[model samples]
Target: MPDATASILLLGATGQVGHELRCTLAPLGAVHTPGRAAVDLRVPDAIRRAVDEIGPDLIVNAAAYTDVDGAEDAPRRAAAINAEAPRVLAEAAQTTGAWLVHYSTDYVFDGTKRAPYTEDDAPNPINVYSRTKRDGEAAIQAVGGRHVILRTSWMYSRRRSNFVRTMLRLADDTDRLTVVDDQLGVPTWAGWLAEATTTICNSLLGAEGASKAGCYHLAGTGQTSWYGFARAVFAQFGRTDVAVEPVSSDAYDTAAPRPAYTVLDSSRARAAFDLPATTWTAQLDRFCERIGTEKGTPKAPFASV
Candidate 1:
């Protein structure tokens, strides 16, 4: 468990996982989440200055250039935030002897594997986003510091403009949706990721758990295609009027080539952290329940972003 007096510096506090981390890490220690204006990830000097100024015991980095399709056109920006920034942070953590917790994605793998990916699986990124994230993971490992890099997939949150929110927003007017069914992965909830991260961090802080520090596949249990995920979201919202059609990847024309199968095998994370696996459907139900309770109706659409 983390010491009560541990000072944690959290980057990307306003992002989906980062926002939830602020709440989950609160009871563990004091969490200082500086806005981008103070610790701009694009600038390496800014990152070094922030780490030096905060002098934190732990640094949880959740920020990244997450635009999968957009990265194809702007690879430099993605590399700056996802690759170089993490390298800088890892170096700083090495210097400070602080435990660094970083988030990665299943995109690191090319969807060629028949089964889910484990920590031992070699990464074969297919796009700019995945390549950059893979580079970040490598940089962190090369630093050889006390760090945990978690690779998750298809993350959605109530606040962010993610798959679930986008589906809800599109269902407002569209009656029929054509979703790709070829790509496969788990739809992880950001809140669940945050909570699991806290548990893992506590374990890492324990005496014997330091040896477990390494890259682990941390994601929601179960797997589904984009079409299946969209259907579940529509079902949760009781939007029977919106028809969801399953289509092959060939039908889509995205700038980036997403992996056809990237469902992460999180057995290592479960064994390491003693974390339970929750199915994606269960999480979706809970998210919908929260939305209903908060808005007093299940049909309350998120204001269009």
Candidate 2:
């Protein structure tokens, strides 16, 4: 029982999560998704105007300042989109009596814990980008609107520029690829996230009502390092010629600090809603199928990080 008549507004409709959101929400009611030209997040007034125009029953924010390295230099810009913009949407949703569905990242954790992080775990961000996301989550809660904040990790899709696509492209050129094996988390597919969102929204629309509306961990089933994920991807693509070597995080020096273990516990989401559990390898296989390999392997340039 899907709500095909509820007016909905989707922000950040071009990004990874937003792109999938568009496809998932298409069967639902009149969905409005605006890009920067149509609705700029920096300007709260623009978001207000869009909300007024759409008068949506639900507002899904899938956009954020996702450039981890860039955020180190431009923390203000990151805060504006990731933190302030979410507050603006929450405010607008509250004013319109619409449910706010927001997406967050696993970077909120400092990666000190050995076990998987739960929704109850306190967030301790290690970088500027993560700090902004933490601020956004707080702002959304402070706005006091009916909301569902989904914190996911290692998200990828065939359409966007993510780890999965990057690895696939690199495999075609290089014989050996070195990826950091220290950091661990689930590799979530954008389509899985989109479909999960649709299921929750539909449940909310039905007579049963929303059983739970708060922060929930939504990602793939198993946990693995970036190197392990790359190896799995290569396995699915049938490209054994290329060897994915594991390296330490110290090998890759960047402006932003990545979480070493941001794996989240998703038992809550599964119990609340009838969500399907799919492994990262399974999803990666499907993704590889979508983006076919090159005719012949190209000689790769060996560039060390």
Candidate 3:
């Protein structure tokens, strides 16, 4: 357990998840978030130096190479940041005797499961990103540090380029949008992920038992295909003006082969922490409202095609 007033070191503070984490961790005492200027994950020495300097009681690694398709062409670069850096961070955390919190992804699975995947599911990553993340997870465990690994999927936010924003933009430009209907998974909001991390940290601090550490799935409540998700996004914008046509994955072949079924079983997280599950539609609603307010545009469901 951490001290009643513990200091935390947070990495990847500029990314979507990291952005929310920075804000959420403020209530925790002395939370230190290093920007890319201060600590670059690409530099192992920098990561080592930052950990040594901060000497925090807890280290939350929100940093990762999240470019799914881009990783295919740049496997070595992805491996360095996604796999090697976490290994260094875990080692540093162990040397400093601090608890570590790392993030993984659903891509770790091959997406062959008919239902949601459990933690025990053997990881058969089909892409470079997943393979590197799996290696990172192994490195974390091998380092023998007190840690918690969260495997989440389809993460997006109102602040960045994501499905929600894409749908909104395309809806404004075209009357018909084609999306892959075969790929299925839950869309996780970065805000929710950050809030959940905060909850878990609080739970860990309150307890006196052994360090509550293990891999768990954290995603939205239900499942939907990308096509279904797009339709919902359009609905939220009051935009019946556009039609979301369902297309097969083959039609939109890309660099990275996406898993057809990436929906993760979040039962363990919900049961363990009693974490509330947010629906996909509700998340889209919140995102639309937030983005609309930010752009000073009308939050209409849809505009005429």
**Model 1 Cα shift for residue 233 (angstroms):** 0.4
Clash pairs of candidate 3? 237-300, 237-301, 238-301, 238-302, 239-301, 239-302
Highest-scoring model, lDDT: 1
For model 2, residues 1-305, the per-residue Cα lDDT tens digits are 56489898998888887888887887778889888998999999999999999999889999899999999999999999999999999999989888888999999999999999999999999999999999999999998767889999998876657886788687778888999999999998887789888888777656664556688888878899999988776666567888878999999889999989999898788778788777877776665544554323322212220
Candidate 1 ranges with C-alpha deviation above 4 Å: 1-3, 293-297
Task: Give TM per candidate.
Answer: 0.96, 0.93, 0.91
Give the Cα error of residue 253 in candidate 3, in Å: 1.9
Least well predicted 10-residue stretch by lDDT in candidate 3: 296-305
Clashing pairs in 1: none
**Model 2 weakest 10-residue run by lDDT:** 296-305
lDDT of each: 0.89, 0.85, 0.82
Query: Stretches of candidate 3 above 4 Å error?
Result: 1-4, 288-297, 300-305
Q: For model 3, how does the per-residue alpha-carbon lDDT over 154-260 read when each residue is reduced to its tens digit?
A: 88875556777778887778999899999999988888889898888767555531356788888877899999988776666567888888999999879999999
**Alpha-carbon lDDT of model 2:** 0.85
Predicted structure 1: clash tally = 0
Order of quality (TM-score): 1, 2, 3
Among these predictions, the greatest TM-score belongs to 1
